[model samples]
Target chain A: MSAEMVHTVSPDGPFTSISLAIESAKNGDIIEVNSGTYNEHVIVDKTLNLVGINQPKIDGGGKGTVVLIKAPDVTFKGFHVSGSGESLSVEDTGIVLDSAQGSIIEDNSLDDVLFGIYLKKSSGTIIRNNNIVGKDLPIAVRGDGIRLWYSSDTKILNNTITRARDLVMWWSGDTLVKGNKIEKGRYGLHYMYSNNNVFEDNLFSENYVGGFLMYSNNIKFQNNIFARNQGPATGYGIGFKDLDDIVAKENLFVDNRIGLYMDNSPHSVDSWNTLEDNVIAFNDIGISFMPSIERNIIVSNSFVDNAEQVEVRGGGTLAGNNWFTNGRGNYWSDYVGYDENNDGIGEIPYKSESLFESLIDSYPNLRVFVFSPVAQAIELASDAFPVIKPEPKVTDNYPLMNYKIPQRYEAEEKGFSYKLFVVSLLMVLIPSISYVFIKRKI
Target chain B: MDTKNILLIMKKEAGESLKNRWFVLYTICFSALALLVLLFSTMGGDIAGYSGFGRTAASLINLVLLFIPLIAIITGGVSISNERENGTLPYLLSHPISKNEIFVGKFLGLLITIWFSILLGFGLAGVGVAIIGQQGDISGYLLTVLLSALLAACFLSIGFLVSVYSGKASKAIGISVFLWLFFIILGDLGIMGTTVAMDLGIKQVFALALLNPTEVFKVASVLVLSPRFEILGPVGVYAIRTFGQQGVFYLLFSILIFWTLIPLGYGYLVFTRLRREEK
Candidate 1:
């Protein structure tokens, strides 16, 4: 066994092949691949440091996965991997770390890869700073960006994944996915039957769906941005379905069709989520909740200029949800009520009512009337006659008169500047008055 | 300048128009049409017994924009022209009142008649809706009535313009109908079609929307009533930006008041100058 020996492998080096370098190397040995293209699919069977110098290319010639790490404590880095076989059944991946504990796969560029980096039963592995872009094909043919199956206590960080299907975690627990920019994919981050995951500071933009935590619990999404994740039928910034014990704080969801969509979340009697200080603006529906979503406390957030501030889907109720915490409610752009006493809280409650939202819970066909005059009339009528209206979709008893979404979110917002608006208003009015006067004087 | 003379003239003009049997018929017609609009909404919806008030009021906005201006113009268009043709204009001028007084009195009288028709039409519909179903939006209903009255006043001024300028009632009425057709239907379509064919920007289209008095009413009325008007996208955004929440109220009110006053002023100027020239 070559202990602490450095085997340099290149296309023109003495040990020209990476597999040969690995065969000659021992556990804890280093094999550095220099610049050039290697066409064979390599398997790291020993626990060694397989680092790429000058960014060497590992081409699988459109065959199987380019790199498969089966050993414990293997460190792979800085390789350009491409040309994995296009087979959904085979779960063809550009890189695979199977039960590779204490491993690191960092700063690698994976192109034309089906499954970018698949972690199967791998624990304590760090996958950071990797750029994984899928082939230019239809979404059905594309595979997962980074799929973690039965992988526990993993750190997936700072990876830019685009055109790949989903950054998914299934049956994985205690995962930390942070600082990743996921764009133009199906779901930016999707969790199913996973628990105790924390996704922080990640940007999920232009994906078909931003993120969804399904059948998962004890998740925390902190300070993330979900923007422009639009679809033909369903565009969600973040969705929670049948989950429990979630905390989403200081997140920003902007310009999505549906910003925060929750269904059957906080499922149990004792289950709850604490969402605070988030900024949700300019989405089609700022927050849409399914009926029967209970015990969720959402407070100190700002919902600005959405088509409908809040909506309830499937004719159900958001029971037991606390709109205000500690006497502080979210700021809404459409709230006409003000705090006459100058205490920052509105004197009247802010009602989240829209014609389509009010009716779509019962008649899905009413969604077609969204933003129509008919829907507007119905919404106004519902507000006037509470008896005819269904239960309040979402009411903020202590709504903030001004947006308290923090200064960071304001930079992203095309805020309606009161001063500029007043000036533009004056500019519009002066001409009208003059026109009236001039015509009359004639 | 004389309130007593203006009131006396206003009372006589009001009495003559109010006594007409068509006032009651118009009021009844408005009530039935408003009810039909509400019923259409109810039939379209499957939720509760009645659709929401905002939906009804919003739809009624379109209805009000269409019919009120036409009705007001027809009713007022015949006023001065009919009086002039019947030799009553010379008789009325033989009195001690000024031309301004007669004009103001007739304008106020026509505005009142228009208001009466609107209130009666909408009041009956409001009562009917309240009685049959729950009151969807009483404030919205009232706002509709108020906006509709303003709209009627705006067109009545236009009618007065046609009336004072024309030599006969038939010509005045024809001009009023043409004005109605232009403002209510073809104005928007022509401008929109031309702009689209010319590939004009949203700003141009928005500017064109502000050109017609009725179009201004249409934008402002719906803009104030429903935030859903934001769905108009870029052009709507530009319009909303130009006139913010409170600005829209002022802008539309100014436009309506302008529509009401400017035409009467122009007509008064023409009438007094023509009579002076004849003398």
Candidate 2:
């Protein structure tokens, strides 16, 4: 057994470049690159530790992948990686861990990158504290911030990504994504056929769609804030499709077009997921369910001031789902039920039905008249006559009298916009005062 | 058209309405509704869990489409028919004025009055919202005011057509209400039903949408004001990409102007060419 060698590469050193050092290096060797621009691309094909001192630059000169790790146990840290090719078809990447297992990629700043930190068929990888910003091109051409394909047991943590398409995961299991701040993209965190994952304490804002999980199971999403992700076709805080055994708890979804859209979640079987203690506020629709969606344990969430709190999109029913669990139900902004016993539960079962909404469900085109007098008139009439109203899609037997989520969000800050209130008051006040004065003078 | 006689008839119509306190009442009515719409919009957004000028403007759409047009058409609908019914049209025509001049004068007069009321309504509402709300969705707010004004003008022109076509004031009023129902209320539903029953896609639906001015108004407003048009799915993106956002807007405005000018032109032609029984 031979001892691992240490090589220091510099512009004027024994080894002038990374490729030169890599060619001479053996297995389990450490290559230190000291603070100079490397204009050439390199591929690590063996077990090695690559450390950059004072943040060395790896510029691809606007062409191929900046750094390619083809070996297992390759650890890269503290490099400014950029200048990848703009060809989406070629999958140009800044740093690609291709079939590299147990690799550590940390503290890399990727700028003007096509794809930042791409892990393909890599397992047991750690991607942490990297700042990734894609090109400011249109979303179609711009690349993903962090993409994991067929990678398992990967931990992506504390990465701040902006202006990228998505931090995407596909067919990856036992992956943990935590403490990331993502904004100004299409989808903040997109998952497809990835199960047994944990996502926590991340912030997603101003994206087209915040985060979505599809065709996977046994995922846990907790304590994340999904805010201000709005667009025409897919502006949802968090959307789930055909999933099972998921727990989405203590998340705050605010100011999106649709907060949580469940499309056939629980996956054609008796529901097993738990959606609890989340606060969904200021969305167009708090929860939009596809007609085939059914049977999830939904409880203790606060649904505040959404336009349509619950919309059954293709009109079958949400009747298969459980609106309340353990004698405790969600809190609705429109619920007028009282808690005489002071147990934080409503006295009567809360019915979520209005005639106008039913009309819209039957005829999607009637949505143009959403806030019309006709809709309002029908709602009023339905409220006045319960017999006229059909069965509600969601009925909470013990609706909570107050919001159950302990966390506060940015949406709550809009509640007391005192500056606006004062200005409006002055506007109305001056006119009335002048009118009164003129009358007095007359 | 004789400019001098047109001015004379315009002054006569304007003076008559002013004497009846019609402008004052209409302005006040519009202002009240404007404020009500503002309040309603904000409150509705709060309930839906989102608040912005776009949401507010989007919510007030129904009021602007339904009520603004109703007011405009009603005011314009009786302008000519009432004169004929009161035995004043003969006297006005006897004063060496052409029928085109009379028709154009009455239209310009009523349109100006309605325009003033519309301006006042939007002015009050916009000023109120601008001062009180966050400036995030201000463009959408202003666009709503602009579109609603165009809607009012469109209906006003339709009202003129109905007025000149009918023999009596009562008949004109009846036809105006029916026109309102057909365009504003029934037009949307009929299109939706037909699209569903016939299994029509976006192209057909869009073609049908062009058939009604009200549908044009709704689509234009939704495209501009609401960010939730993504609910239409990929077809929406395809539509925007195909039309180009500005192109659809230009087309809508052109159609609005077309809807305004076509009936008004035909009505003027008929009013001039058709012989009056009394005269």
Candidate 3:
């Protein structure tokens, strides 16, 4: 083959439009697009390298997909793509790769687009260092930030997506999602029927649901931070459904409604899910499990200050799951047992047997009385009368007695404010001074 | 009608309140309790895993809910009945002041005393929180203070009504304590039991809860502390859907104000009729 040629596309170049340059180039040629707006939909049918100088703009003119890749080994980078059509049915996107394998899309900014970057049957694609923002539409109407359908072996790295629906992967296996920050969206990562995916160092905040994994297996979530996903209906840090061999370790679930929601997970009889060393704190409920969920081992996790630590939906005991593995169990904030041996584990087993909490699990509407005197009264009465105390929901034989606050949460605590100190002092001093002055007048 | 007479009576009432041994004892005890609760709740820092200001503020709300009404009701319950028992009401009625002046002056004076004690107690506790507690938003704490004062005023109005109609000071005190129990304990339990047993609808439960001033206070405090009142669950969602966030807050606030004003107004009318009968 001849040496690969370089085609230039600029406002005053031989080829004014990117599509014209692409049509004139061969399969392995490089098209260098200069800094100018190209308002045309460019389709690449052969393998080519499209490089943008000074981040040239590719405006879709509010039409269909801006760039369509139909060949393998395509490299597209350093461009601002915007103004795709706003039809969800049509799947208008900033860039859509169709059956394109071994493609690299990087260092691009997408805005006002329906779907940011979509891959369909595109394997071995790398989407990295890109910023994606959806069109200014309601959450239900907005399109996915990045979606992969039947696209396996894709690596999504160091991307920021905001105000989009979700970063979704359907039937995409062996994918790696890392170092992504997704905020204010519906779901940060929505995975279904994907296997062997690794999610590491991703931060999802202020979204409706942080990560929803369903019908997926062998997924690992490590060192991910899910915070403030307090949606009205379902604010879950991470939800697991009908999955097996999942490992979630060293993750932080904070300030969400339900930290980890499980429903018939580990569906296969021989499979077991593992959740270890995760800090679930300050959520409305630490973990919510379906009545019949089993075959899971939850250990060494810190369940801290959640209003309800573990709630079994529809009012069934959590007897099926194992709370301790290898003589080590989770740390619970409400454990009243003593550590007689000082072995870092409570001598008495930590049991969730709150009568009121059990009642609330059965009838969620009773949650309206949370923190009310009636709730306190029920607790007091149950303590006074053990007969009314229901069976233990779950028991940890070797519950950890002490837990160090995670480094990230500790760093989030700003030091004591002197301004608040002054205000508090004034709140006291003003009343005292006024009282003294009035006393003297009297 | 006379501002000077009202001020004079207010001054006398405030002076008497400050000098009374029981009042002084109650004030010291409340302040010390507030300080202790704050200290205990925030003792171990991060190792204990307390959620900083949010948890401390929740503790303060509970303490205020249980304590403030008791103090206000006791103080206002005896204000008029004790004077009546001592023949001081008749003696004061013979003075140049109208009955309205005495009633309004007494209410304002006791309100000042209650507000001062509560603010001072929580202020001292707040200072401790500011010094050692974990750093988070203290706006919840400030909201607690403001709402506790409103709660105290509401109960004080109820106490005034009890004091006006009771035949004896002891009777007034007994009635005040009973009212406290009814609102704080029995009434809430009844609402919960009835809602569960009768399977009452959400609107009925909401209305029943608002009927008690303390429940209104509790709802308002939770609304401020939890975002979208998520902690309250379905009731909170219903409230948000029925009345937007600000709407629910203002509605609860107006209900508290009504709790304060109606009882105060009714007590004033009763006291006026008593004066006319005396004449």
Best by TM-score: 3
- Candidate 3 chain B has its poorest 10 consecutive residues by lDDT at B44-53
**Model 1 chain A: which ten-residue window has the lowest total lDDT?**
A412-421
Ranking by TM-score: 3, 2, 1
How many Å off is the CA of B265 in candidate 2? Answer: 1.8
TM-score of each: 0.62, 0.83, 0.95
lDDT (10s digit) by residue, model 3, range B11-100: 778877876786677667877888887777565324212253455566667777888999899888998998888888888888878989
Residue B149 lDDT, candidate 3, scale 0-100: 90
Off by over 4 Å in 3: A405-409, B20-55, B133-135, B275-279
**What lDDT does the true structure give each of the candidates?**
0.77, 0.79, 0.86
Clash pairs, model 3 backbone? none
Q: Model 2, A1-442: lDDT tens per residue?
A: 5999999998899789999999999989999999999998889998899999999999999998889999999989999998999989988889999999999999988998888889999999999999999987899898899999999999999999999999999999999999999999999988999989999999998999999889999999898889889865679898998888999999988788889988778895754889998988767788988885777888999987777889888654577778897798899987978899999999999888877676567656555445444456567778898898967878899998877555344333233444444543543454345434433433
Q: After superposition, how far is residue B177 of candidate 1 from its true place, in Å?
A: 12
List runs of model 1 lying over 4 Å from the truth. A353-356, A380-389, A412-442, B1-279
Per-residue lDDT of A58 in model 1? 94
| Candidate 1 residue lDDT tens string, B60-147 | 7777777798889987789889888888888888888888888888888777766766766665555544444443544455566677
